[model samples]
Target: MAQWYQTWNKPLKNILWWLVIIGMVVSLPLAYTRHQTETSANQVEFVFDYRDLLDISDIQTNPRTFVAEQLKNMKAAGISSMAVYESTLAELKESRRIEVYNSRDAAALTQTLGDPNENFTYVLFADSATQQKLEPLIQKTFADLKVGTKPWSFKNRNGLIIQMSMDDASIKGMDPDPMTLQMLKDQGFQIVVRLSNRRPFVTNEMDRLLKQLHDIGVKRIIVDGNEVPGYTEENTEINLNKMADLLNKNGIGLAAIELLKEPQKGFSTLSKQTNYNVVRLHSFTEKDGEKLTEPLKKSELQDRIQGVADRLVLAVKDRNIRMVFLNARPVKSLDKGKLVDPLAAYYESLQGKDGAIPRIQEVGFKLGPAEPFDVKTTGWQKIARIFILLGGVSLIVLMVSFFVPEATLLLFVLGILGLAALHTLSANLYAQGLALSTAISAPSIAIMLAIRSVRSGAAAKWKSGLAYALWTLIKTSAISLIGVVYEVALLNHVTYLLVLQQFRGVGVLHLLPIAIAGVYLLFFSENNTYRDKIANIRSILSSFISVLWIVVAGVALAAVYYYLSRTGNEGQASTLEKLFRSFLENTLGVRPRTKEFLFAHPLFLLGAYLSVRYRHAVYLIFIGVIGQLSIVDTFAHLHTPLHISLIRISYGLVFGALIGLVLIAAWEIIIRSWKRWVPQLSK
Candidate 1:
């Protein structure tokens, strides 16, 4: 033993350990309390939408002034684009007719007036005799025929979408506007011409409409796919592609298709065109299973907006796309001809509760650098500060242990308290989610714990195979679980939507933990002997290989999940999947744990439990660490909630531990049975 080891006093060490514990218990909650307010992460949601020119234009008023005001409001509200119709069918001359119908034709029209939802105004040219023959029907249908030279209109659940026909196929653009669109353009406006088809989905007249918008300086087109009802699987893609091509020729560069299905092949091909644009629109058309309309309660309106915002962050995180369009008329339900308002409710939805914006810049998206921010996060900087703080604490632990060997208990207590304090400080400081901070710190903690465990025993007893696996798993899981609390701090302050946007991965955070672990292992020679140093290196390298195996195993598991979901028998997964499903169905009740929870957490927990004592328990526990990776992978997708992730990992720890105990019990039983059978065979 070293001379310094002999001088270490037991009583002093115990007192120091208790002091560290006392300090931690008090400071940790204080940090949590300081950061307990609502989320303040800054990120701008780039949202745009289409508004009816009728929203601001009224034939009854000075339409130009109203439209210009709406446009200016749009610019101020951070709206990236705006859309208006070339013209509705009701606006066309062909839809209106001056008819002095004979009494017989009027009688026939009167018979057909029962339902107004069906298309009406069919043109008929018949002799006087034929009209007389058809005049015996009810007078109800004739009521429509008596009204001469007026436009026909319809009302549906959406209030009104006026239909019109092309009066002259040659007239491309809309009727004259109040202000030159060139002004909006000069101010950096992106105007899209919405082609409202009275005819179904085919773009027979679209070629003409595109020319008019192009002539009017409109650069984008929003196509309503429902307008094209005649297309099939074979022709829809081709027809859409052709429409896109037509738009390109007219110098209309962007096409936004509001299709309900996955985009067809032709759209994919057209999207690649240099001048052609296809914004894959995911519209929040429904609220509580009904289409969005006015007259909804204020609470319902707020809920719907929040729900859409949450989905937006989740939907676009890794999609590799630049823009998203929200199809909404979130302004209060205005009366007909009452469209002179900017969508204030819609803009309110863009912000989370208390106007908490996430860190859009951290997610590698910056709409405008000069845009003012009410909130911001330290991002990777806070993580670096955390790791540095942790490293200092670790060094203090090492130095104290080196001089006073009897102070081992105190050092251990100090380490835990320091880690807890660090966790509290980081949770308070970064204001992003906690998983990233935890994930970055985990591997280092595992390395340090593994070193401590190995130093306490004979090196050879734990050097190879199952022993190494057990050690790695236990150490890894303990640290991973430690990281879980970091996110628990954030649960009440933000929604899953804001959390996903702000808490996206940092490259430094991903690599720092592994780097810290690697560097620490290099100098952490077991027993301070050259032989032990080589062994420690070898062991750590083996641990790295195991970590690689865990990673590969995670990927392989994902591939298997995908394949099973897509190609399994009748699309049914294997029994193991079913078992997880059953477990979740029973335990999670209606809340529903995801496949990540079912597959990953329990397995990691199992690894953690098995890692307790058995020499080969690490093999089982390795799966648990893989579970942690699965959880980490879930974050990359930006879909899982912070609380949900916590629940999943916590359940995994408990359930996995139970499973491990069950397996160990069964194994012991099998061993006893084998012994008895062998003795009988020998006899």
Candidate 2:
């Protein structure tokens, strides 16, 4: 009976094992194909809406025509910097700067002759904020100019090449009264007081400005939006209501509230009591000014504009408002001679549908197509995948269960030891699973060889050979199980979060299941009793120490990476440190406030202590998992919302109770099985 069993079991088991091996080989390529198919890109379509077009007739008129013409010549010359001399003929003869233009002739003849000097600056007839937005662009374009100072900062656009300022002679209405001049100055009109007309509460200068604005092609504007600079009558309720109704009646589309700067003074009756929904306006300043004539330059602008456009379009699509106002530096000529179609231009800039700008534009706008929605893996698909992977692993395990069961037990233990070691070395739990798989494959073959050796009586130490083979299997299983547990818990949390938050980090937890399966193998190695294995605690300690050394090596490597990144390496040391710090802070709830020294922190000591202590490993694992699981509250670069110490205490208590319950249940099962078997054996 023994002979027949041995002879048939050996060949039959080998054949069954080969079938499982074939299945695994088939799975790899198929799995790769499935993964690729799932992640492949495909075309999708969606509608998009663009923002309102700019109104620029004021910059295109007679005196202002020179500003537009100079800008046009500058664009044509590709020389943004220019110098304006007193005489046009003198400037044209010896000067290379863009020739100055007189206030009238429709052509407003300004032509660039040659290269302008680095210090050459443009004359802007606009306010300080409008001038501020030109520095970055000017500096980059005429890079040699080092035109880094904003227009508003300098006494004049250093050379007054292309000027944008109100014509000085246009200020005519003055009663010549000291009190009135003082009152205008006190009312905050050093440059020009654009006031409300025919109103009991305010002056009439704004009505005159609006008339001038209309003459210069400003068909629609809201004078009420312009906040009077120095009108600090404590109760502005009546003023705001009258202003709002006046604006609504006048059909003004834009308003500029000036110097109501204190946002936290709390909403006054102007905002609270009125129906005029004030959309906060933001626009380009001298500090933010950069041209976008190039393709990539425009792409950047498109992205930013489209992002805000998409948000607002979605938000305000149902409203009757046809145009929204933004403060922007005036645009005269977009490209040398090409006229940008205002209606078509704004629509194309929306970055929607076929009109979307190409991805290469380099502009401030940071817009792009919305990311593809990720489909949640259904339960059946997940179950199928999990079963297939586990089945392949279990087949190998089953083979070990047949012969040299004790060796299988040892291998399982060793595999777990290797897994924990690998995890410490590489924070990835899935890498530990792969390492366990590779480590166990060799042991499986070795056990088979050892069994053959014992069967043929080539070596007399059959019991010892069986013990070694079983030991190998047990170590492998332990590693596999530990890895599995790590994987399951992590993946469960991660997948749940992905479902909840729809973030990419959700897939990060998927690695945990692989680690758990690897760990499970460690716990259930074939035919080895816990009593027999407990005697090898010294060996377990040695393995633990060995893994600890590898962890130390990893720490040394991380330290070296940190040091080189900071000191001499031409790399982003600060960025790398921030990334590492972010990961650690999330995992340990031990965020170092400053980026001064990461490796030398007390947390490193804690990690070292946990590495050396087995009990601490359990605590660190739970703390690490929960710490990673906790929501991060980030304000700028600061991350909050994790309390590592609390997490450790809570997880330790909960997991300890769980482990105790499992042990008790396991003990009870063992006793029941023993009672049933022992009585039968005695009978």
User: Which candidate achieves the best TM-score against the true structure?
Assistant: 1
Consecutive 10-residue window with the lowest summed lDDT within model 2: 632-641
**lDDT, each prediction:** 0.42, 0.32
Candidate 1 positional error at 36, Å: 38
What are the clash counts of all predictions, listed in order?
Answer: 27, 101
Error of 1 at 175 (Å): 10
Best by lDDT: 1
Error of 1 at 202 (Å): 11
TM-scores, each model vs. reference: 0.38, 0.24
Question: What is the lDDT, from 0 to 100, of the residue 12 in candidate 1?
Answer: 45
